[model samples]
Target: MPHKYHESQVRRTDAVEPSEEEKQTQEKPAQKEQSEEEKQMREKRRERTERGREVGAEEADAGEKT
Candidate 1:
């Protein structure tokens, strides 16, 4: 016996619909604003670190001369 592969058998006749929860999830906005705030906070932290390093180097130089 030969196997039959038909287009009608593979195709779906009914339209697939999203459930209520799925619809709500699709509608909800992700935390893009929160992510931007976090990025800004990280940049500020890096700037502070660089400044502290420069100050530490200056202090060490002053101490060496004393």
Candidate 2:
């Protein structure tokens, strides 16, 4: 009598090749440049805040009656 198999078996050497899109995603550097741009944006925002404060103080004094 022949023996019966109870479970499915997978080969150890089988490997699925990465798709083209996956390869491109792995090679992309957009995130690194995005963070640098974000840092620059924050610096600009701080500069704007400082300028606004100076303008606001000048406006406040100009509006007061001496």
TM-score of each: 0.44, 0.41
Q: Residue-wise lDDT of candidate 2 within 1-66, one digit each (tens)?
A: 854643342232222556688777877788778889999999987876676687885664564435
Q: Pick the candidate with the highest lDDT.
A: 1
Looking at model 2, report the run of 10 residues with the lowest lDDT sum: 6-15
Query: What overall lDDT, based on C-alpha atoms, would model 1 receive against the true structure?
Result: 0.69
Would you list the clashing residue pairs of candidate 1? none
lDDT of 2 at 60: 48
- The TM-score of candidate 2 is 0.41
RMSD of each: 8.7, 8.8
